[model samples]
Target: MRPGQRGARGRRAAVTERNPGREVSAAKALQKVRGQIRLHLLSHRTSVTASGTLHLKEGDVPYTATSRHQGTASVAIKHIPQELVKRKLLMINGDVHDVPVEVVLILKATGGPESAGSSAAMYLLDWYDLDQELILVLERPVPCVDLRQYLKEKGGSLQEHEAKIMMQQLVEAAIELHSKQVFHRDIKLENIIVETGPDVPRARVADFSCGCFARKGHYHLFSGTPKCAPPEWYMHARYKARPTTVWQLGVVLYGMLDGHPSFDTLRFLRNKLPINSELSQNCQELLQMCLSKVPKQRPTLEQLQHHPWLQ
Candidate 1:
């Protein structure tokens, strides 16, 4: 109830983001908390804004039946606002979460891959039946730093030898997940984790809260961040699920070496998209195959690894 910076375990804890209602440290030392970002929901407070627009996102489930939220991106708003909040706030099996539980589970389940063994991710706690609340234990990576910062500081492009090393590290990790039949639908600078150890920078893909498992024969349609997404993942925008890891892999490769994608535009599929710089022939060719109109045309993870560009 009191608003002031308090000490945690005798160390000073700043009122960092949003103030917490209370901070009681238990045995494990996990902080019982409040949200950093408070959303205006239809929970005994707020008004209706809009309705009737459908949206698509990565993974099997969606934020809503309409109003597309693509890729690893977190949506701050949706078309059917109150309806969605009511479901999240009230808690019901049929209740729809802004972020689908399956997505989070899929991410959590990938503690490790064919080789990763166990990358860090949050653990899910049960929901309260009455209000549809979710409890998650934050499991930060052992040595946490994403590629986004490094990419930005470097100002695009990697040296030949360095690129090769990064490519191999991420590729092997990716192959490990694919072997387990997992598609880390969202792969980008924001998700790759660099451990602070002697190990060769093993990349642990994060944001599985947007990942969907591709069953042996059950294909589900969805969308990803178009900038980095394969055409099959973007064009259909509602097409049945297919193998998109290959596509995303290519995009990330482009991003790593170039700082951005071959396409410099933001939200390529969205309106008001600006003119993007031309991509190099090698990069364009790779993106072309990855962004092929058809899903079946894209190369497999192993095949992409062996491509001439990689060589």
Candidate 2:
């Protein structure tokens, strides 16, 4: 169930300061704040704010060093949002929650905000629009690493039991996302963050820049990783949300068990890479069902949640 939207009393004071005598609804006041907060914060930071630089107060600067730039996105740490703090939304791996932050800020800045709602699997804390670039503040799980690096540390492939635990969590996350009408097009190892500090490793799905709202029709334009795309995108040049998501889940599982990247669409179409036979029969069956060439043959997210392999 989605979190109940709580009215923010603080917004009234801010709204009344600007427009005296004019009463504004809490929703409208929140919308106004979302629109103005980014510009207000950016302008008050310094005399001159660099195009891509995130300047915090002295000794509070979060970024230490720089690295090679690949895509348009880059990572840097900074302060948390006071707005979010006011709502008491900050917590470490807490219960599932949602903040009533405007969707426009996230959607306009990141191109993907459909999945930004409450989910233990996602860590979208807050976001700001800096005109030239967008600033996204995500939750950092201490003593954690990406699933790809974690796999390498585990001798390149995870044991069936470990993989089963991780896959069960991921499938549950997928079901939650599906219930909220959020289709995360990219569900790969690199995008998944695993918290190793816990007794059992916990997985948190990250990177929703390729996400969109779940719909009934097929989507022609694919925004996720090319190699991990479903076969329908290659053969038919179109794919639906759930089927494609299942296909990507299959790719993630294949990567975890095989310790190698899954095949590209063309190679998968030709059946160049097969599921590892050494895996248990249930695991192999789930892989086969998910990696089916025909989208219709693949099990739904609900079925995956109840699959014998996961159980």
The candidate that wins on lDDT is 2
TM-score for each prediction?
0.53, 0.66
lDDT tens string, model 1, 62-171? 23321123353222221222222221222223443343333233333443223133533332221111122222223344444667765665576655456566776777
> What's the distance in Å from true for residue 242, model 2?
0.6
Which 10-residue window in model 1 sums to the lowest lDDT? 33-42
Give me the candidate number with maximum TM-score: 2
Which stretches in model 2 have alpha-carbon errors above 4 Å? 1-32, 35-118
> How many clashing residue pairs appear in each of the predictions shown?
16, 0
* Model 1: residue 33 alpha-carbon error in angstroms: 23
Instruction: State the number of backbone clashes in model 2.
Output: 0
